[model samples]
Target: MVTPSTQEKARLGGRADVGAASVAGAEYSTIEHALSDALAAHGITGLAIRADGGIHRFDSADKPKGNRNGWYVCPTLEVAVYGFWHTGEQHTITTGGKADPAAAAETRLAYQRAREQREAERRAQQARTAEQARRWWAAAGAADPNHPYLTKKRLAPYGLRQRDTMLLVPLFHDGELVNLERIYPHGAKKALFGGRAKGVASLVGSLASADRVLVAEGWATAAALHEAMGVPVVVARNADNLEPVARRLRQRLPDDVTITIAADDDRFTEGNPGATKARLAALAIGAKVLMPTFCPGCARCTDFADVALCRKERVA
Candidate 1:
């Protein structure tokens, strides 16, 4: 039976044999002691890196808290960030101001070791998950006319592959397949775990010499707009990622190409993160915002896809 102390150690990267209780304080002496504490186990689980070049931690991989990365250490910014998803505790430490060269070097080395371990873990996990996505993508037939998500959304699958009953959308970054988002028949969705997500997005139509492009939070929503407008849609996967993915897209495309931020109006949510973030992203790149219009008393509809489905139903 796992004791409370043991469980806590596991969550803290499972090196309790050399953890805070054992190595910290009067029990150990010398510079080695300080180095040990600074370079805690940090574990292989719950480890991920953002596209913005930050190392991150999650509470648990099995039951992940999807708000933001739990803890992150940014080497470039010379900062370390810590936050708990449940209690909302956050802290940041800037290591750049250290005056002692030896101490600073020690600190850098400690963090470097920890970062290397976590990065190795990330690469391995991504390789395994990417392979799985590839096999699923390979076996999937073209989107069927009667696939539930397609039929319900009134959208066609443009190169969207499926495995079994789940719709698979390949997420890529810099022309490499890094992750995937699987959509259920009822519209429930999830992605393969332990892969880089920030700035990673799915594309529907080819951007080859296109003058206009659209970006949105979800694949279904992108598909809806692509069908209606005949423009390429980039799926940023989530609202929080709009800015990162949009910034990258802006940098990649020509200055003349019009990039529209198609936002989801989360009317039911307080602060409406979707629309707010989309606008901010658009503003950052001097792009335009395209929001969905809802019908009278349409409290249930939050996105262009929802509005389109509602209209299609009304017409039928």
Candidate 2:
């Protein structure tokens, strides 16, 4: 009986010592703290850390509320990764003094996996949004020519459809309808969430049998150019998209078809982004650039549509 009691006490002491060591290790190697510090360095704060090795999304500090542009993944107790999808910002945190070769390799693999997962999810979301676009477009009616936006812009409907007071501008990519730009009566515009926009475009007229084509930034600019020049106009939707849309058109059209980028002269804006992007796009494809030239002493016109409307108003 005496021997048995002594052995039991020795076993209990050993267990207590192991438990204390484990607690000390946990206190010293807190991965969550390191991750929090890393995020703080990027101005991202107030996020609950998830250590399950799964991607978690949160709103970025700079974006609007509910944007959820920030995401993080903790693949192991020692490694964590986070990024902002909107800004393409990524950061990683690791515990311990310096990462060993194996730990570094593991972190790289985790980062790659996170990126792949994000891409897959993005593709799926885009597919769903595209299907929704098709449904809404098919069920809509022809755009009312007297709509406020059309009347204000002095543009015709030009194959646009309308649902209630909102005009739907269909965007296509790879010869498939992939998105829609909803233009409200107040001139506000929005594209479907998760829908593809890069390299997508809207057309104001037929390109078939045409010897020349013009690419413009907005629908109104494209419409004005098409109406004046009697040439099909491709609406790249914005300055940033000018290059991608022009590149795709160059690839699809025959070599003899001359491509011209109709630029918006944003004189008031620093760097003149519209004209700058247009010139870059034109240079990329060996195309010509056409910028709207405002009248003498006129400072209000920025694009072809604005120039046309301003001139017409002056004449009246």
Candidate 3:
């Protein structure tokens, strides 16, 4: 018969000799399911557990108390629980603690369950976002010829060489392409703007017959406002470009025409170079500036596109 002390020594040696065990077939699904079952046993819900070569803990429904450290514990002879914090690092406990072994194991298992779920959810969301981007590009490629903004040249510039269907160019006014900001389906890093050309000019010529013209940085906001109010609009491309564009506009437009600069809230913040540039531009050009009534939950008011996208979420 194996003595208790001898068995304990063997068990301790097994954990200490990390290289002795091979991790060749450690499937995340198996570990994740085990962690989920463990949390359910402990009456904890909405916890997530993740595992690569090891396990991690997270809270899916709420932020956990404490410093958001990933905690890990070995619950069985073969299973270990691990946790992850926002920084994507993992943590584990293999020694003594204030709590009893069983309670500590339960806590660690709960954390692992939560971490696994979070990782899974993050991957799912990324997949969905990619799919949405693909659909947007396809739709852009098939743009209607009769549409005022849709032109073959405009669509051709944004088409991805690798994926002809994907267009990175964003629609600014009706269908007019602005500054060629980015080519789509290629992803964020591939966004290209009209070099030195302000995006606001995309809508400058398309404005309604009004004495007052409203200007913003982003194409989306300009388009949204134009759609909402039958008024003339100019998009500055970005905050820094606004002043120069405004100066040019002042020269071209009738002297009595009122110009309003749409100030995005981001400009007022301490370290925004773009906002600082816009302020100087507005001051020099003698243009009246107006801020959106609602703060768009970010730094700058670049346009009405953000307002429309975020308004429903803000209200809810």
Best by TM-score: 2
- List, residue by residue over 116-142, the lDDT tens digit for candidate 3: 665576566545544554455555454
* C-alpha lDDT values of all predictions: 0.69, 0.80, 0.47
* lDDT ranking from best candidate downward: 2, 1, 3
The regions of model 3 sitting more than 4 angstroms off are 1-179, 183-195, 198-200, 267-269, 295-303, 313-316
Give the lowest summed-lDDT range of ten residues in model 3. 1-10
Error of 2 at 135 (Å): 0.9
Q: What is the lDDT of residue 301 in candidate 2?
A: 89
Clashes of each: 0, 0, 33
Cα lDDT of model 2 by residue, 1-316, tens digit: 0000011111211110001101223332666776666666667787778788888888888878888787778787876656777776555555654445555455456657766887898899899999999999999999999999999988889879999899999999998999999999989999999899899999999999999999998888888889888999999999999999999999999999999999998889999999999999999999999988888999788999999888778887
lDDT of 1 by residue, 92-206 (tens): 2333222233433433543454447566877898889888777777788876767898998888887688788988899988878888898899989999987778889999899
Instruction: Rate residue 207 of model 1 by lDDT.
Output: 98
- lDDT for 233 in candidate 2 is 96
